[model samples]
Target: MQRPPLDPQLAITFFYYRDLPQAMRFYEEVLGLTLAIDQGWCKIYRICSGAHVGLVDETRGMNKWAADKPVQLCIRVSDVDGWFAYSQSKGLDGLSRLFENDQLGIRAFVFRDPEGYQIEIQSTTRTGA
Candidate 1:
């Protein structure tokens, strides 16, 4: 008999930041993500779409862990302007510039998460991509 392969429903990455609680609060309270797991050492946050974001410690890691930049995480949202306004109100730093990329045909804005990581909120006119 043939068996179904194990499928991964979500994508996760270990994000190393200086402060964990602040990140947790930003993801949980500000972004309205549910706290799936909350231990002293690590935390797992789940957003409305069932995706997760993991926060990890940076102190014990190698010096390279404290790099100037990390990979950006693009989050798809229905309303980019609303979220941009909300992030601005929360004192989150966003890229001073905004533009439309003719190549990708996506409307997006870049903003920094609590740990200074880059995040993009994009939306499409169609119901689904």
Candidate 2:
């Protein structure tokens, strides 16, 4: 029998930012993520049921902010088109046209967050995808 992996209560991806207020506003107002925890310098927002994204103030965080952000935050939703329309209304930076990836079986679009971090909104196109 195969052994089971350790079960964690929550998952958080932390991103350090030079301007924490700008990052927080983008996540809260634009993305509509609810704040789960606030540690003064770090703020945790719930992305989904058990997933979270943590924004850290670079001055107080373990890591410093970098100009070239290589990480991308992706959210899988049921209504890609609706979300696209909403995103259009907001005039998000570096917004891309809605597209599909047959191999990945996803209908998606991407845009940059306030600090240039790429955020991908996608939905499964085919069953069992």
Q: Estimate each model's TM-score.
A: 0.78, 0.94
Minimum summed lDDT over a 10-residue window in model 2 is located at 61-70
lDDT of 2: 0.95
- Considering summed lDDT, which 10 consecutive residues are worst modelled in model 1? 60-69
lDDT of each: 0.70, 0.95
Runs off by more than 4 Å, candidate 2: 1-5
Clashing pairs in 1: none
Question: Candidate 1 residues 9-99, lDDT tens each?
Answer: 8755557778877888877787787877765566777754557777766764333246566678777887877877777777766564454
**Model 1 alpha-carbon miss at residue 69, Å:** 2.2
Mark the regions of model 1 whose C-alpha exceeds 4 Å error after superposition: 1-6, 48-50, 60-64
Which pairs of residues collide in candidate 2? none
Candidate 2 structure quality by residue, lDDT tens digits, 15-69: 9998899999999999999999999999999999999999999999999888898
Pick the TM-score winner: 2
